[model samples]
Target chain A: MHSQTPTCGSIPPVPARAGIGGKPAHYAELLAARPPLAFVEVHPENYMGEGGPPHAYLEVIAEIYPLSFHGVGMSLGSSGPLDRGHLARWRKLIDRYEPALISEHIAWSRVGEVCLHDLLPLPYTDATLKLVCRHVEEMQLVLGRRILVENPSSYITPKDSAIPEADFMVEVATRTGCGLLLDINNVFVSATNNGFDPRAWLARISGHLVQEIHLAGHATIRSGELELRIDDHGSPVCDDVWDLYRETIARIGPRPTLIEWDTDVPELPVLLGEAARADAAAALSESPHAAVA
Target chain B: MLPLHEFQAAMASYLSSPPGPDVSHHLKSMMRPSLRSVERRLAVYKNNVYARLVDALRDSFPAVERLVGEDFFRYAAVQYVSITPPKSPTLLGYGKDFARFLENFRPRRIFPIFPMSPISSSVTSKPITRQTRFPSASSGASETATACCCIRLPVF
Candidate 1:
């Protein structure tokens, strides 16, 4: 079993600023410009392949900027053992890149040997909670450091759910000692979809447990009478989501926030501009000007 | 009250044989009307899953869809789903068998040259090549076999 040795000794504290999902199209210009970004977040799956452009570009970027591995396919909530192959690959990447942070979703994407491409929801029951905690413990052990688990933007409420989302997450963190990657946009989407208040959800989870934050756009789909916002991560961050993000950061103070634009990825400047906007908001919240506004 | 396994089995059956009359009867007793209006509404959920899966394939393999045309592509997709349901929860990783299905599908063989030319060319140009390595049947059986083996070779 792998164990975490506190590597925080030599590593600088994670910056309290904004960054963007590192896309290949923007690699050169981003490195050349070295625009004011706290760090870059990458989907570990994209870099899971052997030596290629993804690595080449990431190597160049990592030299000048901090990097975080935000994985989408670990299936941590699955009712199965951890994928040894996936963990080994992740371990290799971590060894090479030494990302400032490593995170995965609090949802499952696989069952048994079958992989589900979607980040499917898990019932918030005791069985599911135990399963997820065991997986997190295995992951933390393998990675040799703590990881952050982000709340997934759910589409449907499971029939067997026995606990509130926030409470479930809190319990998981308390049990496994994993940190939170609180996606503010997901909070807004889930709250709206499930008839809960976003503010209350944020209030339920704040401070030390949360080590990072995520902001992304979503699309609203009407399933019968209920309009659920799907976290497509394919567009500009919506104004309402942005406002919720600002409020969350203001209340919680700043963490390493990421502006994630995955589908219709704009130019480097467009993404950097969004990151800058997030930085400005975080700055305002920290400044006296925010009180007046 | 149905057991969880029974419910999952019913869902699997409904998804597999959606248009079959048996689905409606099974769905009627199992699913709450409030949860999903009726069998018709349940059909919509099935449709959403299929549509999303198909869209994912189309997005990932535009050239293949373009070569087959929209109507034919959808028909083929339905057949593909029935034969090989998505193994991965991630739709992006599904449809690994579509290109093979096209190669063996007799109806599509009429187009004869469809597998090469425009479709294969377009796919090679995309950033999604990491997901699939579609083969051209015109390259002869031995070559096709070699290509298939190469494509199936896992990345990591």
Candidate 2:
């Protein structure tokens, strides 16, 4: 069995500042400009290949900056058994890069034989919660690190759900010894979509458990009589999300925030600009007078 | 209370093949608001499953997709989805079998490789799986595989 936690101590920790999602377009400029960044977050699954340019670029970048492996698969919510092979591959990446932080969504992507290539929300029942907690524990044990579980944005809620999203997450974290990657944008999107208060949602989470933060752009479109906010990290961060993020920083004290612009990725300067904006916001929250604001 | 796996099974049916007459009544009870609202909500997941997976195919095989033309590419994508919906979370290896699909694709080969070339036959084999490497030749310009990444799952 793989060690429950990483045995090596090679990579440095990420600073609690602003950074961008590691996109290939910004690779050269990221190295050339050497933007002031806390760290870069990459989906670890993308680097699972035996050898390729992704690994090549990531190798050089890993040496320079603190890395975070944000995983999208592993289907933690599945009723089916965990994929041991997938876990081994992920462990390989973690062992090689020794990322500062690692995280996955509080959702399922597969059940039995079917693997839907998307993050599907799970019903927040005791069974489901326990299921996720088991997966997180297994993941942490396999990788030998307490990984972070992210709260997912939702367009629909399950009728079987009896627990509030925040409480469910808190239980998942507390039980598994995992931390939270509070994507403030998801809070706003999910709350707005489901008719809840974002502030109260944030307040519900145990803030101390939050290890890192994700700030990203979402696209809102009308769904029948409803307006659904899709977590499409394509565009610039909107004003409302910025407001929530700034407020979150005030509460959480600037956890390593990542400005995630995944789709329709713009130039490095544009992403750097967003990171700068995040820094400025963090700066506000850190100022002595920030509390007054 | 609905059994967790059963709820997921019903959901899987709803998303994959669409529920039929003898569908789970628990599905409607499991949702809120009205029946129409339930459908509107469910459609999001249904659309997402097909669209995202199709997009994953479109992403991984962009050059081939372009060669086959948009409509035909979309046609092939839908067929692939129906036959082989992603069995894993990551899209990393989701479309690994696409070359096999293209091999039997019936349409003219979209890839630049000529029919005469020996590499074309083993498009689905492990040799082509890891960039086309002819062992006989020491070092020269080699045909590189597409660098695949997109969608929520960049790997499977």
List the global CA lDDT of all models: 0.67, 0.72
RMSD of 2: 6.1
Q: Write the per-residue lDDT of candidate 2 for residues A1-293, one digit (tens) a residue.
A: 22243333555567889877776656776777787789988887677665466777888888788888888778889888888888999989988888888888898777786877667768898889888888888988899877888888877788778899999999988787788999888888888777889989988888798989888888877866767777777678899989888877887687899888766667778888899998898888889888732
Reference-based TM-score, model 1: 0.79
Off by over 4 Å in 2: A1-11, B18-26, B34-36, B99-156
Residues A1-293 of candidate 1 have per-residue lDDT tens digits of 22332344455767999988776566667767889888888877666544355577779889988998888778887666778888988889988998998889887655555543445556677877787888898888888868989887754455667688888888888888888999888888777756678888888884788999988887765646655566667678899888888887777788889998765557777887888888888888898666532
Candidate 2 Cα deviation (angstroms), residue A118: 0.8
Per-prediction DockQ, in order?
Answer: 0.12, 0.26
- Residue A251 CA error for candidate 2 (Å)? 2.1
User: Which pairs of residues collide in model 2?
Assistant: A4-A144, A5-A144, B90-B155, B91-B153, B91-B155, B92-B154, B92-B155
What is the Å distance of residue A68 in model 2 from its true position? 0.4
